[model samples]
Target: MPLLDPALWSGKASIGTWTPPTGGTAPVVEPATGDVLDVIGVATAEDVQVAAGRAARAQPAWARLPYTERAAVLRRAGDLFTEHAEEIRQWLIREAGSIPGKASFETVTAAQECYEAAALVSRPLGEVLPSAEPRLSLARRVPAGVVGVIAPFNVPLVLGIRSVAPALALGNAVLLKPDLRTAVSGGVAVMRVFEEAGLPEDVLHLLPGGAATGAALVSAPQVRVISFTGSTAAGRKVGAAAAEHLKRAHLELGGNSALIVLPDADLERAASTAAWGSFFHQGQVCMTTGRHLVHASIADEYVERLAHKAAQLPVGNPDKEEVALGPVIDAGQRDKIHALVTASVDGGARLAAGGTYRDLFYRPTVLTGVTDASPAYAEEVFGPVAPVRTFTDLDEAVALASATPYGLSLGILTADVMRGLELAERIPTGLVHINDQTVNDEAVAPFGGVAGSGTGARFGGAANIEAFTETRWITARSAQAPYPF
Candidate 1:
């Protein structure tokens, strides 16, 4: 597939060409091959302010349209995704280091998000409240004007559209700041989709830049709600800035999620799930199983099987048909993961299989004897590495899993499905999977995390629409009643 032209985004940002106040242009590097894919102009604070102002002006007219009319445009955009899936897949592989399978999944899921968000037009926003007197009282949901979406590099396209589609569906204009690494496909490509789908210009603005641009968006008075997905450290700044400015901020942050295996669980299936969960997309996913807590009775055999599975999976160029794991985002990320793995092994975490990298391609690594204090066991490695531990008691396993500051997602594998469900409830994370891995998501499900993972503001279903809207209470009287005012 040929690389997309950078001219695709030229003059497409808020109202006109988005000239950066400084910092010129940045190269988008292909991590797998270290290729200079293209260059994108960086947006500045001045550009962010201009985009937010345009979005604010465009939003009220959009909100006044019947939801069905708005849904039509979004539904067309959804259809366009399926029609252009292959091209999007190619871009994802080149720009984001997504294997073919992962790229396909993201593109299809993103399309599904657009389709589902269209249905949100019919979803009830507010309920009628019963009154003691003969007055009628009810609440109506209204758009929060302009929504600011700051998405991360990993899974940039889907995560960007996840907020953008729903915000537009709920009658709000959007100011989107996609990750600098994925500006071309994730940000500019999406803008084209909406534009060709007949969405009015200025309703959706794409500003691609770094932290300064994001900070400007968060602090913009015209931007009423801010929805962000990225690292916890970045999210903290975005959240605090939005709060200081009194903007509604909804964040989907980092995670160090876990997958637990009970003694009676299917070892073969559990091993397969573990390998896939820990290494898919080079484990860049927020819900990737960073830690594995297995029953002591079966830990040895399970780890052995998992190691075998990890070793056999192909790890190479994301463009290949058979490669299961791809490169991390960049050399810095690869070095970070490598350093963490090296430190963990030095700290007594047994390297059961694969602890090496060739350029950006890191092997699928599995470790045992990882103690609670090990960095591999504690932090979000965000790489294709799995660190397993043994636990005799379920309560102990739950406590150990919840020890991290993140509460994003959890997975439990057990023969007893009912017991897994019970344990799922006891888990502190916002999402839990029974007899499955931690890295699972659907377009229609309520997706988010709790605690350090996120703000508990889910991104799908009716909650998606609610996140971009505000509720207003209104009352009507059949007849004027004497009041002491």
Candidate 2:
């Protein structure tokens, strides 16, 4: 699919006569060649208001539909996603700089989520509670009106679509604000699915643009809920804006996840899993294992194995079938990674391997001898940099992992099942994986974080449905009984 073809898509600003943003459209460059893939329209605040209003108007009828009808729509959308997978995958590679394999995985995963959501919505809301008097006390999940979805550029399709699916499945209309960088690809994919599913035209509106558009969406009174996934700073702003209007907000923000390697663990497996988790999507994932806490006895062996694996990762064009690692999202992110690494080195952390930045592509970096004083140990380095630290025992490892204010996800690798179970209970993070890397995310599990990581949970089947809906209880006393209060 050609990027930025005025004929292909109606821009967020207006229907026809759609022009690219006049602020000299920034190039969405392919990370490998620095080639301009497309120019996305930077939407203004007015554009977002229009979209939000449209969605709010369309929500009532959608919410009134039967659960089975909503399920059918979702199923059809999933089928359409499968049919157009190839086209969407290509766009993902070009715009988001995701390797062919990873891009394909993301597209397929999103499609699967649609199908799963359909099944979830089709089930009964809740069973009637048994009561002494003849009364109907049943909990029913009802849509929370129009939900504003602000998606991040990294893992655009999967993370972006996740917010929409559960909300839409529960009969909530959505105003999807995709990141300008990957809007063409992500927006097109969503539009195609909804169109093919025969959903109401205004049920889901795509508002593609930058920060200004997002602010407008959050501020609009029509938006009942705000679902956001991005940087901690941006998330805070969105949350505050939503709070101003007393609107419901769900946020999946930044994380500096840790992977703990116990003394009795298999070094090779832990090393391999950690490498994949830390470098996947150039380590831009909120759940990616950016921190490593290894037992002192096995720290050297684990670090050496991890370095060897990192060195072998195939870094090249995202469109290439064999490429394993792709570029950071843009040059700005590249500079940020460089600055963090330099500071870490200056703070006395030893560079274990791969710490250099080249234009948009940063090498898969690993740092050791990191102290709490260093930013590398404390901050969320959303890059392909893994900071390793040593721990004398399990308590120490757990303590170090919990030191950071953010508690999103953490992984523990060990052979002792008892120890793993015990550690899992003590970890402060929301999700903990034993004998695996932190990247192990199941579609059905409750995926989210605690503390600064953000609020609310996604996935976990029925739990997700409840998150997008509000409950109301009804009582009838036959109109004959006097006031019992």
Candidate 3:
């Protein structure tokens, strides 16, 4: 298949594409082959203003439409996405370097999000509260007007759609700024679906560019809400910019999540889940489990199991179905991962498996005997590296798990139900998985982090809808009593 032409995709819409700022066009490269996929047009401050103006004009009409009618449009979009899943999957593989399986899963996840949002919108926002007097009181959940969505490159389809679907379903207009790396693939695929479903051109806009474009969207006065998913440092900057305008912002930032393996846990299962979570997407996920805290009684055995499993993951072209692992997003990320591993090794951590970077592909790495002071344990190693530490008991394990500044997601592998529940309550993260790894993300569950991990929530059905909306209280009394105020 030929690479998608941005001009052609934008031409399909009535509103048309925003032209690049002077001398601002940049190449979008495929990580695997180092090939230039396309030259994406960058947006300027004026471009953001124009997009926001168009959204403001279209939002009221969209909000006025009945929930069922709005849902129908989204449902049609889901169908369109399913029809073109393969093409989108290939694009994701080339641009984002997502393995074939992961790419396909992302597309499916995006489609499922659209269908789920449609179903959620059909239900009433709130129920009436009974009152002693002959009056009515109810809560109405309403949109927050124009929203700015700044999505990350990793898991672009899933993360971006998860935010955009709910915002649109709740009757808000969205101006999306996808990461410059995978903009053509993820951005164009989503815009095509929404446009084909008869979404008003003004209601949805795709502004593809680099940091300047993102800053423009966050700093725009007309943007009422900003939803961002990226590093903690970048999230802080975006948060500060949004605060200047006093716009509501939702951030899903960095995570150095830990996976705890208890004494009674199944070693095989823990090993497999740990390998999958740490290596999947080359550890680019914010919620990827980078730290493993295992009970000392079984720590050595579990580390050996993880090493064996890590060696089995095939590192090759993302387009190959059998390739379990692929390259990191780019060479810069590869270098970062490499440096972290080198520092860990120098700090007395034992390298149990892979630790070398071949171009964009970093070998699946496994480390043991790491300390809390080591960077690998303290920071978010966003690569295919797993650092393991030993704990004598549950209390020690919990302490190690909570040591990091991030509290996004964590996992505990234990057969005992009571122990699992106890740990789940004590853990500070937003989501906890029992008998699994940190990579487990469900569309129906509330998936956001606590502390530096993030603020606000995504998924968990109605909670997501609530995140994209504001609540208003409506109270009614007899008309004769209206003068009392």
Candidate 4:
């Protein structure tokens, strides 16, 4: 069949095994135009149970395959993603509200992630260790059986694949639960790639539904690990539920990240960076620069320049116009973003640029004169809103940045790279950029956050060794000699 032909998926539930859904069906609506794209089944708790059982049964043989054979499958999957990039790009634009550039980027990144995961298979998996007794000892890495991946709507393709590809590459079966709004791009597309790449039947299950499905996946007895990417509030619940089952949950959660511009930095360059960091993908990113901390001496010029950049960028339906930003996921998200802006303005922050939206198309907004009391300044807006604050010195900048419980990503721009590095040490964030924006990702870099942002279960390169695998100690003796008895 053609890639993601609407008729092919209509009334079907999963990308694996072609089983009918037990939780009924949901219409796939395009948020930008309010058009029903297709109809897909919504999986229920019972479906999760069945998927878990299938995964448990299928995992052993898959794991027993030769490492080279497994790696070859992943390599083929990567190539398939590139070969079908245009088709995947279209789905991302229509289903996830991604701009053309963003859609293209996702396809490239998805292929890169799969390639990286392919390489992971041949990496040194175990190490020899010293033993006191006359025996050979070793420490080995093994897959956590039946991994459960729960991904979000924003950046669906990258977020889902980052976990799914690596977990499967490590010889674990996966049960993925993607948010309903962008299920086709996030869940179904992934299933198709692995399926065509020749993954064994029942090794991966795609469950698309609401909270009930996610909860079922998290708490399933057969699910040994959970990989979740979403809000902090929901992440906390996932963590708790997984703990109740004594399983680990890898969480890459929310953030109200900051971008600090020192007085010595280039104003024009800094302004451009700030605008991209806060407004790219409509600021619906975990590492979005929610707070802009500029030195007081250069704050006015920076705000003015940043506001101009935000205003110059166009916003509309990506399918129709050439725009820098497209509509958010839905109406509820738009309302929440506007309400935060209104609260920030009511609390004394000045609207430096945009503060209005049409339907789901929220304008890129900038704010000045913000304080700790401003809601948008203090909260994770998850919209195209940038709230700026002025700091007199490095001490005040550090103080302001550290005030939030979130410690995800921090960016600092300055002429003196050494001083920027020095300042970064004082902050508690997981990732830092000396002279770049906060919204950055690579298939090779270890990406995640700290504190409320997540459990610090990073995904990428060598980090995957720890995220998806468990360490075991094994010993071999020449013979079974004498016992105490």
Number of the top-ranking candidate, with TM-score as the measure: 4
TM-score of 3: 0.94
TM-score per prediction, in order, is: 0.96, 0.93, 0.94, 0.99
Over 4 Å off, model 4: none
Which 10 consecutive residues of model 4 have the lowest summed lDDT?
7-16
How well is each residue in 226-334 modelled by candidate 3, as lDDT tens digits?
8899999899899898888888788999999989888888888888889988999999999898899888899899989999998878887776546888878888899
Off by over 4 Å in 2: 1-6, 10-27, 126-135, 477-485
Please report the TM-score between candidate 1 and the true structure: 0.96
Better of 1 and 4 by lDDT: 4
Which residue pairs come into collision in candidate 4? none
lDDT of 2 at 428: 85
CA RMSD, predictions in order: 1.9, 2.7, 2.4, 0.9
TM-score order of candidates, top first: 4, 1, 3, 2
**Per-residue lDDT of model 1, residues 1-485, tens digit only:** 22234555443343333344344678878888999977777778888787788888888888888889898998999998888888888889999999888889888888898999899988888889998988989998988889999999989888899999999999999989989888876887788778778888789988888899899889888999999999998989998998899888999999999898999999999999999889988989899999999999999999999999988988888776568888899989999999999999999999999899999999999999999788988999999989999898989987888788999999999999999998878789988999889988877888889999989956888778679889998889988888998
Off by over 4 Å in 3: 1-23, 129-135, 477-485
Q: Which predicted model would earn the best lDDT? A: 4
**Evaluation by TM-score, superior candidate among 2 and 4:** 4
Q: What is the lDDT, from 0 to 100, of the residue 451 in candidate 4?
A: 95
Go through the candidates in order and give the clash count of each.
0, 0, 1, 0
lDDT of every predicted structure (CA atoms): 0.87, 0.80, 0.83, 0.91
